[model samples]
Target: MSRLFPFHGGLKTVRHKTESNQQAIRPAPVPRRLVVPLRQHIGAIAKPLVQPGDRVLKGQMIGQAEGYISAAVHAPTSGVVTALDQRPVPHPSGLADWCVTVESDGEERWVERKPVDYHRLHPSELRNLLRNAGVVGLGGAAFPSAVKLNLSGHCDRLETLILNGAECEPWITCDDRLMRERAAGIVAGLHIIAHLLEPREVLIGIEDDKPEAIAAMTAACAGTGYQVRVVPTRYPSGSVKQLVKLLTGRETPVDGLPVDVGVQCFNVATAHTIHRAVDYGEPVISRVVTVTGQVRQPGNVEALLGTPFVELVELCGGYQDGVERLIMGGPMMGFALHGDEVPVTKATNCILAASAEQLTPDRPVMPCIRCGACVDVCPANLLPQQLYWHARAKEFDKAQDYHLFSCIECGCCSYVCPSRIPLVQYYRYAKNEIWAQEKEKQKAELARQRHQARLERLEREKQEREAKLRQKAPPRSEPAVAKPTLETAVARAKTSPAPTLETTAETVNRDG
Candidate 1:
């Protein structure tokens, strides 16, 4: 069994995590206002269902999923819709996106709820419930879980299930703390997933450095069919692809999902949320977030989604002055927000409010020297240098040919780059451009089809009109009775009513 689940490539990263794991998880105070971005996940942005001046209760669906892959957004607290406009989001570019700004009424009230016996329900029903509850991958990918679990009909074989509890990223301990404190919930969630997939076996992988988490998870799995496997602590061990390789001994093919190798991996936190959502009639209203780095009180907080970063910082005893950057998630893959005003969303697992000492300043970017460090650290084994060169030259097609989609944008290239170049940014730009171009192509194709259909209809109408005119014409057998000579025609006209000008004109006009 162990042979089937061998570990894979990873890196040793600095873990400045003294603040979070040292203490028990605590709930952060709710802020007076919350700014919830419509797009918190990796799919189509949810459309707002509420307008300004409307009131919303906690766990109320405020945004509807826009497309098949999108997830709905719930109101994090009982609040009034103060505004629905653009606001700064926690992004690498520090840009703004459409958001819902709500002023809290201090009533963390609950709406009506009902739990579904997920075990008794069909797989589709379970997936729909998960979708309605707004469950998504909590480890930062934010991919909708329903879309993932609905893959059973597409496959025939079941091999392994990997529960990723390896919180290997520095300064992020939300998953670690959850595994330690809520292992039962995690296990319960895993059971739900197991029921859906019904794989041959289950493996829960945790980093060895987190002994408490390991022990708790192991205790939870004692009599169950699940197996808790402790892996060496390494950066990116928690990544979906890497963890899949570590637990299944099967490498996911490029541009493929874990299911390609008859496997599935879910974040421990994501599993626990599934348990709560399906079994307890609870929606994903709040989540455990790690608030640390250069703050007076650095620790974990169970924060409501859409809680402002500033409020969280204040709860963590505020910054000690000279804070350089506010990062969402971890330093390795996390993005720096332009300001502390952005609110926490379902995807926000950690907020690292770092000072200069905590986070190094952005150095001037230099040219890549082909040292291959980026290639070495890349877990996906993609050619980062080649992709970087293509991106720099705006050769997007060449980049795609090199499997740009397989890059994973894990920030490994940027992290190990000697040039300090923002490789991930370039990759993102390329990806967006590609998507935009594909959309344009689709639009152009549809327009061409419409135009051709219209042209065909016009041609058919013209032909039909000509055919009807031909059918209505007198037959050739009805030719004029006599071919009159010029003198006979003139004598007939002269004798007919003395050939008045008006009469001759009317007769000729009528005959012609």
Candidate 2:
């Protein structure tokens, strides 16, 4: 309804939707083997409840949630556990993490399940049910839904819950197809959310280009309180902040979430997963994925969690030719995989087998010509050049002040950069550094607490000794000298500043 172009910086990159969107979503034939990762969901890495040589049925819990913010992992199909160890996953480093290898049985048997009448249950009961079902944000974030639903009573006057259907990524058609085909199920899930938040307005934001999805969703909400809002087709329109502004004209503050602006957004695919979890009592064991790019037959496939990319590619007729790169998700936000051995986790929305032409063209480094193209397209309104300068200089704290975390690493800045700088990589490096620092800070805080507690114990003992001495004899008239406090004793014992154990260890370890 309002002007769509409120932001200054955005890219008009090539849209490669024609490759997969033309065909209706086809079920990806079951693979003979599925490599299930234990830590598919966010928060804690799940601990395997089943070991090698154990038989597991489809939808059965194989890995238990590790901690409060984790989700359980279910068997994608009836299979026997073949292996459980570190294996390559879909990450930028192509690094290996803990995973479970399953040898599938062709029968596709499902475990026993009982759906709950969610309407009659309390909010906490519903939240617990969703948590046990292993539901998480289906968007690339992969955040646990239960934790988000149970936010600290900071959310007041919560008005709207937005369903993001704007699969803005060029090659990812999973969400788009899901909405078009399963609109009713998604709407039913919306009702579930409505019950939880009791928001008067529920806006389903889909890109204008997705006419079929919009029409289907509109019809699906015919008698319901939900409202379908078709937004302009724009890159990064599906981003939480961008979509919020587009739908509600509210600009969220820096370092704040959608809840800060009286809104909560969930991916449309996530809604469908909620429907399946609440209605059928099924966990998030599998999801729809768009496997496209240099593959022979590019299309959408409902893939089991922890499926190997190679297996998905094979189902799609394999690569045609000149498959120079294998990326997970779209070219803009996806990470390039070293091989197809990486498993499809809950976070993976697509597996892109890109050729030289489809992927970013490899070019020599160029100098910035003060083009200001990058700044013109940044969704976060951050100065890309300033971030790059600080990051390259290793000024991490300064980068944080510039809202480096806000950079979604959508590749828009790098996409339009005349100099072709790897801007996102720098931001990633800075973010990782910040996280590492935060961990160190937390450890230091814990150590301080322990030291304080020990000091308190020692002081209590000294006080008890003095009290016993006084009780045994007449109290001295002279004022007792103030016993040296912990700080005083430590100061008297050391000539110089006392080095922390960590610092001393690092110094010794480095020299050694």
Candidate 3:
């Protein structure tokens, strides 16, 4: 029996996962138009490669990774650039961001594909290739996969590499289905990651609810020396820290990452993408998304990134009558998006078209009565009530003092809140405000540094000019010496008359 490291607190919420997992995965039809966002993944937003009116082939690089931390963006279809402008994207704030609009040509044309033996190339080269391929964490964190592959910065030796297959979120069944259907691909991807990290042990954590996925993945890992461990069905177990703790019993520090504990994690989908990128030379053009909840027929779709949510909903037989909300993920952690026009990005795992009669009915938010319900259910073992108080009062620093960043925003607190305080929303607002303030401070500091540099440069230039003038200046001429001539003698005698006058005055006084 695998020794289980149980986490502090979690809920066994209603798992509405069967509705979507019952059907096999299908490819979402390429829409007529694609609104690809530039800043899909975490870190810097990708730099656009094509302007309006430019032609692009599917899988061709359209947006270059801004830096080492960013992932590249690609064209999902062969199309003409209709517009490069800001459009509404899938953000909690429902804000508009820069998007590359492409009008599809229906050709589905692909760029040249070149598979590489990653072992033959330098590790840095392989990472760069993944960056160009636009591979990132597909389990919704959307962190650049290539950046995580390197373990040298984290520790001297990696003891474990975990592949998170625990699709613990209630409505999100994308990872579960991926494991069941594409187990070999996921395992192959894990092998590639092992080559990069060379971890001592590899483990894939899946929840007990995914029996099919667990069996499929276990059989797939038969010869790979990787273990597929089924964890208890618990909400938020799929999260990085919790999953790591479940599998390895290691607690990532207060403000640290998984790597700090001699462990690293990758989403199973991310591993599959890495495999495809290295083995078949495929860029991350599409992903499997779960379209579940109150639709006529719900299922998972291998959707091209930038496919409209409306098209995806229609693919699932449109929203059922009396649909109240359209959420982007599970009802527990997901945010309710305003419209379906928001294109899917790497982070989109599930699109829940919720009906009025479904789970988590709209409840009136009331004042907190100092209840400890949120604290008991917090998986991170944080004091949710204190964090909520500080956040609601705009004491962001105090919230941080209570380890607010460690909260994971899992909504467990709000779920158990008797008063329906919307605790998670308050935490998110505090986090955003803190981030904005930090960004402003950074900008101000950068500007101050630049201005100081400019002043120093001007002063240096002025000093250099003065030094050059002194070097180029002519030497002063020596004072002309008076020749002992009549003119000089006369001038001297006139000037010396006062000395003779003193003697003459003395003689005149004697004569008187």
Question: Which candidate should be chosen as best, given TM-score against the real structure?
Answer: 3
- Candidates in order, TM-scores: namely 0.87, 0.86, 0.88
- Highest lDDT: give the candidate number: 3
For candidate 1, list the clashing residue pairs, or say none: none
Q: List pairs with backbone clashes in candidate 2.
A: 9-376, 9-377, 10-377
**Model 1 bad stretches (over 4 Å):** 1-9, 93-95, 357-362, 457-512
Reference-based lDDT, residue 490, model 1: 60
Model 3, total clashes = 0
Ranked candidates, highest lDDT first: 3, 1, 2
Indicate the residue-level lDDT of 480 in model 3: 25
| lDDT comparison, 1 vs 3, better candidate | 3
Supply candidate 2's per-residue lDDT for 222.
92
Point out the higher-scoring one by lDDT: 1 or 2: 1
Tell me the tens digit of each residue's lDDT in model 3 across 231-338. Answer: 999988999999999999999999899998899999999999999999999999899999988888899999999999999999999988888989987888888897
